[model samples]
Target: MPTPKAPVRGRFAPTPSGRLHLGNASTALLAWLQIRSAGGTMLLRMEDLDRARCKPAYSASLIEDMHWLGLDWDEGPDVGGEYGPYVQSERGAFYREAILRLQRDGWLYSCYCSRAELLLMANAPHGLEQEGNPRRCGCLYLSPEEQETRAEEKTPSLHFAMPDREIFFADGVAGARSFPSAGDFAVQRADGIIGYQLAVVVDDIAMGVTDVFRGWDLLDSTPRQLALFDALGAEPPRYAHGPLWLGEDGKRLSKRHGSVALSELREQGVASERIVGLIAWATGLIPEPEPCKPQDLIGQWTPGRIAQEAIVLPGNWMDRLR
Candidate 1:
């Protein structure tokens, strides 16, 4: 694979709702290379905003797992760098500001719909999938006075009043991406908390993120986030959706089956370098990286070489001792 040019920042943002799995570790390694090879900063973000689900144990285990996988970061929650509040929960005010900006710009609105209503909307003949409509809420067109009255009455949530605009962004790996937008998306949930889409866009813009490297599963999400960026009148960043790690069952790895956690491999006595090597291999960073230590891997890093498809690890991959 071709090496990435110098000085281009990228990051690994992981949610602490669970352990750092083999899939998570692998992606981190690839993102590390994507940033490090270019002499750019690799930021580690703990996406622990979901207070009900995110546990401190999971966060600690995730950090330990990343270390075990030989992945390091130049900036992160633990180290406390220039981009402090590396955890999403700490950045609520920032998200509020972005949402408020959209609100003032007539690009967002308050939605008082209940979940049952949303589900019914989804089940409506015009609704598609469990996702319902891209433009779901019926209350998005409320007048300012009506919206203010609802706000006074403690309405449910705020939603981005998606504009009728074509969305497109150049994926560093996927080349050009284009999506026809039907409508706006949610910003804050009915529970008065920010959603992933809103917070991520706000965070990226606030953190001065120029580039994003994540899994292909989120490829569709980029367009929505880009639209949110447009609603806020801000330029969006470049994106790269790297390979995913699938199970031997040919499905993307998940907790439903065992072997999901990186710590599990450590318990099985697999060397961290071997794991890193497999990630590098799976992601097409190298056809094979000999001496797979994280330091060695980083030294030989190149973002342009990373693969664009989901990489399925061999069944016996975890069994082999390094």
Candidate 2:
């Protein structure tokens, strides 16, 4: 019998709070390019764990938008994989186990500070942002008695205790990066919610992810993740920070600036091919050519060709999509 091949895995995870936007579509395309170029398998996961905001319509639209764009996932919520239950919301027990493991290892503690209290402390005149051991909040200093008393009064949040050293890591796309990541960061909220830092760390480790391609906006969050990986004795995955697309004002593209969702763009008569072409142009996968379909562009797409600098979208590009 032939030996089983080790699957090369890449994933696209979108929250179901809204339809996918241009920026998000671009990201999905880039990730697809990377996975395709590697001849690897790609997966999709709905980051719809936030029950208060998640909408079924939005989730359906996300899948529909990806289908319109011709992006396919080899494994996901729709199709079962060895890693079933791809949605974070469905993996509650996994997170619970991770939290328990961290707690037993003395890597995490329970915090009981309210949001207002934390804000007041953070905004104090003498507030400090320490490097490796950045003073996040003084809540870490609370004695066991105080913690128990607070626990009896209400619920306590969980925090990951960071070490005192500069965290540095090599980026696959952006190159060597280092940052000061001090401060006791929250792992679980007082409302029994797991923070991104904690959730992503546990998920990546569990999924055996080898690479991570995300926007430059999340570059700052890398150090904290690195710290978590170190604390858990897990190897960090290869990292890449793709260039972010901005508006003419040079700010990040957001809904406030008329940055509609990807599905909305489709509804407004924007062709999926043009949207892919725009991303290719902006990311330097292919320079601005006259016009082309998404399939034609993907055939020549290369993830390594993405530029490091953020590209601002042109107004006429939207018109071209029409």
Number of backbone collisions per candidate, in order?
2, 4
TM-score of each: 0.86, 0.89
Let me know the TM-score candidate 1 reaches against the reference structure: 0.86
lDDT tens digits, residues 217-270, model 1?
A: 999898788887777767677788887888778897886556767788778777
Error of 2 at 78 (Å): 1.3
**Once superposed on the true structure, which residue ranges of model 2 sit more than 4 Å away at CA?**
1-7, 120-132, 289-304
Highest lDDT, which number?
2
